[model samples]
Target: MTNVASPVAVVTTMDGRRPYGTTVSAFASLSLAPPMVLVSLDDRSQQLAIIRRTGRFGLNILSTRQAALAAAFARSGPDKFEGVAWSPSEGLPRLPDSAAWIAAEVDDYISAGDHTILLAQAVTAESAEGSPGPLTYHQRSFGTHTPLAP
Candidate 1:
């Protein structure tokens, strides 16, 4: 398995009422046969704990302009969503600037060394008016998406 995402993924879940840690990393689909996607979160992360207990999560594809959001979520974190602008639907926290957002139900969890693999079924989705591409994590820093020439 390769350790890279099509673009960095931002995972969010509610903490009682407030949104906590927006996790960003190289995440991708684990199985199309079963409609499954996986995200790797550190074992000690609050996001992992919330996902396990609530059994639901949202995957938000960040647009290139959302580099700050990506960095706020990706770097060594603590209350990552502190000042981020977002709203909630069915209790799922949504970042409005995301290129696309998908809501999912936890199907299973896999233990992979330092991280827990969250395998979930994408149940609902919304497409935002994106500026262009997505936020990419590469070379130990964050990168923005670029539009290719026709």
Candidate 2:
């Protein structure tokens, strides 16, 4: 799917008193009537295990300037948030300066191939004012979206 361009995001959850997260590109709006989202995670992802245990998570849609942050969380480790600035929102870790944020409760988990698809209901949603364009991944490189002339 390297040819497919996708928005970058970080899926965060609290593991006891510690915060954990992973970078993902497979997130999408699943529904509107009931405010829902779908996030796909590798079956072996530690973050997925946390979400299963807690039944909740926060999605931080990264901004154009957050490519480094995305790379940081994408690494396999527990220190992804070591120096990252964030706060608790609805009891979940919320990254600062993201393009958008969504806190959701897991409604179901669907197993597909090597990944688990989380069907979640959004409990809280927010968009930053004048945030930079969304961060994107395409062809194994980080980038951002640009509007075409009308």
Q: Per-candidate TM vs. native?
A: 0.84, 0.98
Evaluate model 1: give its TM-score: 0.84
Alpha-carbon lDDT of model 1: 0.77
Q: What would the per-residue lDDT of candidate 1 be over residues 23-89, giving only the tens digit for each residue? A: 5674676766666677888898878898899999989888877777777787666667777788886
lDDT of 1 at 119: 83
Candidate 2 residue lDDT tens string, 95-131: 9999999999999999999999999999999999999
Clashing pairs in 1: none
Q: List the candidate 2 regions with Cα displacement exceeding 4 Å.
A: none
Candidate 1: list runs displaced more than 4 Å.
1-6, 32-34, 145-150
State the C-alpha lDDT per candidate.
Answer: 0.77, 0.96
